[model samples]
Target: MTPGSGLEQHPLLPWLALQHTRGIGPVRAAKLLEQLGPRWFLSPRLPDCGLSEAQLVQLLTPSWSVLEPLLEWQRQGPARHILSWDHPAYPELLKTLSGAPLLLFVEGDPDALSLPQLAVVGTRHPSYVGKENTRNLVTQLVDVGAAITSGLAIGVDGLGHQAALERGGVTLAVLGSGLEQCYPKRHRRLAGDIVDGGGALISECYPWEAPQAHHFPRRNRIISGLSLGVLVVEAAERSGSLITARFALEQGREVFAIPGAWQNPQAGGCNRLIQQGAKLVCEVNDILEELVAFSTAALKIHPPATEELLPYPDLLDNVGLETTAVDLIASRCQQPVQEVVTRLVELELAGWVESVPGGYVRARRS
Candidate 1:
């Protein structure tokens, strides 16, 4: 179905027009939408709609040239969709951000946006361990029913999408370039796989817009905005993933960073993030533990059916977030240490639990 099918007239034109204005941004556009309802955009009136003189004049005379082609593009693809800020289907988490996109171009399952999401991000050039960590964590995260969100760039972002799809999980790739101009051309096919796998390719730029330097950093906000938390796998001192983490902090979202080898230049950003108080994650469960509390609020809107407990739910509950030894956990669960150790490994891979220096701890709540 079309994104705005039920409406009398497509609202894409006004939403696109509002974004196209030279000086107006998401913050200003949101204000305008709040003051003048859709009728003002449809009727093109110049009333006291809280806009400055220049903005009022611009609103009165929207650039139809920029909007017309976008409308045409939307009509061409059945799965393509446009989400305006006021649309009921807009992501609630994203809508809370002052810099959230006024218009989002989606090219897959739009409902995917409403699902619980965790942003996985890192440097474009990652170490082997970084790639492994991303893939393993993404697979485990999806296994537990959480959707993965990433930028769909090279390295960590690309690995995140591939891992999610490989595990039969849903993933969302937030793009810096438009759908038509997939950045890092090497990953174009990967982009298709994401949509084909029931995931989505999202962009704030027009379909034909090319990847510009500013666009990537600007798009970082959406990555953090869409997710409950941002997880940094690996990053250099100055990397885009750090930018996303900063945005996550500003948006009141949790930030998790994986510690890498101290000497690896790629790890500088992540180490600094931990020093600055972002959660230090060693394995998948670490991320899940942080996500549970954040996701609880979103789940309340339409309470989902309770998730099926993993094997050994009782044993898992015996291990809390606090540190505990294997012997102690075994004693609490009334199981043998050998069996407990084996089960803990399984739980660690599934992201339900973690193993520490002393013993094991609950990484995710049952």
Candidate 2:
């Protein structure tokens, strides 16, 4: 739903009441949402808690009792709306996660929240390879129409934001802290670029909430929940990146990990994830191929390859990935080197090939 549609005429109001009932958390909210449809949620007709006696008490007491603050927030108009549990804008990806947020306090660009997103996360201190891979991947992902989502941390996350901006693409930064104070303090510039590029900044907590260590793990769930998949560029064995990856698995979103050198400490978590069945992404195609089944953005934003590069002589298709020199290409087409070189230049301009150290490498555009 759009911003103003949060609880207006929806059955979500009573569910929000159940959430505000002082100790009732997500697990409890799920049971009650199904039980109380659009009517009064506190009705005595509800049955006994399926949870154990101890769990029952936990369910009855609203763990999230900030209903008044939340409602007051909604009263402020749609500028800062809260996406309730049943709203349509609530990501379909998030619906799969257990203990999903009963409501999400939204900030800027609510419309984009409905767009397909790919979470890009990694260590605060990424290695050279990690940074390069992230930049390239983010550019390609955005060009293919997937909005980049990251924490805007110093390393890989920062690179993702920068790449998206450089390519004139959109991005979303999920903050561990409130939007009032963009964390890392240093990334204030990068955050500006994101917003300027039509990206948004979001968090599960309220606007005044401050960043804390504990808030990060919970923030990971939102990162995973917003995207069709979580892409880990680089992460240490116990890094926050892994936490987001774990949440992706739990949320039933695909988990894609970029492989880094074994000698690098940051690659450990991603490599381990690959061992546990996460898709290993060496390049953007690996990511695109995996996401194609779920999204058609790749088919739309990605430009077609040039005629010279067509694998089967079809200008609409990519000249297959092959190993051939400019000389071979010229000879095969029966054209002069200068003529062939000009043709290749045009193809390169259209994102079909790249000049390598000794020859050209087939490149794909998104």
- TM, every model: 0.76, 0.69
Model 1's TM-score against the true structure: 0.76
Worst 10 residues of 2 by lDDT: 311-320
lDDT top scorer: 1
Residue pairs of candidate 1 with colliding backbone atoms = none
Instruction: Write one digit per residue (lDDT tens) for candidate 2, span 1-366.
Output: 233544344444455555545556776666655676524345564545343555444434442334545666567654566676677777666765667777676655666676789999999898888888888888778777888888878888888888888998888888888766688899988877776677777777765688999888888888888898999999999998999999888778899998878999999999999999999998888777676675765334443344353432422232336556777776666668787777777777877777765556678662
* Residue-level lDDT tens digits of model 1 in 241-279: 999999999999999999988899999999999999999
Which residues of candidate 1, in runs, are more than 4 Å off?
1-9, 34-46, 296-366
Error of 2 at 107 (Å): 1.8
Report the Cα lDDT for residue 31, model 1: 68
